[model samples]
Target: MESKDLKFEEVNEGFNIKEAIDEAKRCLNCKNPLCVQGCPIEHNIPAWIHQLSMGNIGDAMSIINEKSNLPAVCGRVCPHEKQCEGHCILNKKDKRIRVGKLERFIADFDSNMGLIREKLTPKTRGKVAIIGSGPAGLTVAGDLARDGFNVVIYESEPEPGGVLMYGIPEYRLPKEVVRREIHKIEGLGVTYVTNCIVGQNITVDEMFDQQNFDAIFIGSGTAKPKTMNLPGNTPRGVIQSSYFFRMVTLNNNGSVGRNEVPVKVGDIVGVVGCGNVAMDAARTAIRMGAKEVYIIYHKTIEHMSALQTEYNEAVDEGVQFLWETNTKEFVGERGRLKAIKAITNEGEKVIPMDKILLAIGSQPANRIVSTTSGINVDERGYVITKERPYGMTSRKGVFAGGDVVNTPQTVVLAMRDAKKVAAGIAQFVDAKKLLEE
Candidate 1:
């Protein structure tokens, strides 16, 4: 499809029934599944594929649900090229099994067929307040809610899914898929409170002191984008990729209209960085009508942090790359961006452009830590937690996980961290309850 035609449409057309079964049959069902070992959440790959091969897709989905709450989302956006499929034995023969495609197919099939059986009731465990409805938070809520914990997710945005809702492009991951996955969690009796920024509207202390939540899981993801100290950073068209993506997603969902995003038709776009976010920004810029979209990175292509598949997709979509390039300044006229001056190994060059999107990276927003006392964060602003105790923060009875505790990572990795912290929280809360008894 042409770049101009890229809308909030589903990117990969999911597998149909026959395709799913055929793909599942490709799996040799290795006795020792290295694919599962490579997965962050350690999903039962062989088991699920075996079930699918047996024509029991519902059972396959149930097996998948044992470890994943956002299978459909992960199936769509997870960098399987580097993880599961990359480690597949089939790759040795230059024939990697299409694990991600198969996983997505099963999740999509289950969703369409209403095959996700409810696994929990509200008759056990105490109430837990989960802050931030991102991957980690949502995973914790889903797992705990399924274990009969009254899980309540608090989100700052109007929607429930954080990065899944805003950061990811619609063409890469459709909004409907996110909504469907979230609806499954809601079906498990999880409550959601949107438009509520925790630590501002409700302090962490209040969650325990006044609200009396038995436990708390802080998965508030990193929100503050890092920026270059280059001259003219304050120019009109110099924007962060996160903000740009948020605007694009909102515009696509009718939360706003076109022109709300800073980019315009026929514009030349310059994207700074070479991560997945950079690829997303460049592709989005092209789709937004940019005549040309350039990804400017200080490192070589091999050093790029973006997944190989993402880089390839961007190239396929006509996105350009300027490797080993560093921005010096953004030149503007009448307070709007007009061109960018950058330095490469060869020397300096001025690239005329209408917009510059910054995708350097982001840091955890420390607002919650600032508002709540006793919690400790590193000098770099990451929450400090014990490894053995898993997700316990500096203060007792408080747990933190996901991006807030580590560098910005993939959704599934963050979910893996949250799963560990959930076990920690369960242990801590269960011990406390025993002591009270």
Candidate 2:
């Protein structure tokens, strides 16, 4: 059976006060608190839960805000099963406390009640320019701004939330929630320059020389989509998962419309790859009124990189999977997709498909590094950083983190990396000023 129709209004409604309090009571308040250790950003899980248990909603939120700037976003998307919740001692008995749900509860409660953090002190530390408005960029901006740094973020997209705004689906994370979190950062004196591509609109030297930024953080994530070099690849119906998702989810007041739609009703969609992106594409295709959605992967089900919960949800929503399959070519007629020529574990086969979405992988866009010197990237093109200053690139005052420095990982993991980079930037700025004095 198909799961409930996922509208734009968030699929998982966060816990209410009563439900949150009741659930918070489940925590035994372990002295060790393995949940905190398991957390990527090391949020004080037990302390927040303890506050929630005593009906201290604001106090609970205060505790969460100390570490996380995007609590609502992280609570919604983080893989708690593999991190915080997975480490709960209570899980030994299969009754672990729902930490992620309680976190979302506290964050949503704070926002719904218009509870905002007090404004920060004046920007006295140093000026830092952050490239990208993704989780990593936002994390660095928020953390540095709290330390009294003048921070500005340059985002290529029209919206400021980077992946939170465009890459992530609306069903999983509401756009309003992301906007609220960004507003909180803005209230802290961090400025955002939207529709401003750092390399294209402005150069790195300009940020340092003209803008007089003391330091730069490159958090522009991997955006170039990877594709299989196959026959008949030039088809009208072929699209990347990222592009399809944006076209489907972000158009016409945040709903799909007929003015310029990527996929149409009754189309048979075939999605390549078996990772989280592939699952998101397949499920989104189904939501867009596709007659059938198939997830084609070259690997077995066991080797699929998608999270089990996401995989299970897609299966529950009627997304079919073809395992151990390799596509040889995409056959089309009159420049439109018609069918896919493939080979399964058994033999050759042909799957008729009206539309195809590629979700194999992504690579870092070379725009920023290509136009700048002294910034070093690995042979694979990922930026190389130092261990001493903790995320500083070869360029003295420039730093890099997130997908620009490493492979694309989870959102919280990117935040974790950015947290360290923020600390490094603060230290570097302080030392530079001291030397000048």
The residue pairs that clash in candidate 2, if any, are: none
lDDT of 2 by residue, 1-437 (tens): 23334445566778878999999998999999999989999999999999999999899988898899999999899999999999999988988888998998888889889775666878999999999999999999999999999999999987798888887888888888899999989988999999898788999999999999999999998888888899655678888988987776568344546545677878889999999989989888877778888999988999999999999988988899999889898988988889999999889998899999999988898999999998999877899999768899999999999987888898999999999999999999999999989
TM-score of 1: 0.97
* Deviation (Å) of 364 in candidate 2: 0.3
- Which has the greatest lDDT? 2
Error of 1 at 186 (Å): 0.8
- Report the lDDT of model 1 for residue 402: 94
Model 1 lDDT at residue 265: 84
Query: What is the total number of backbone clashes in candidate 1?
Result: 0
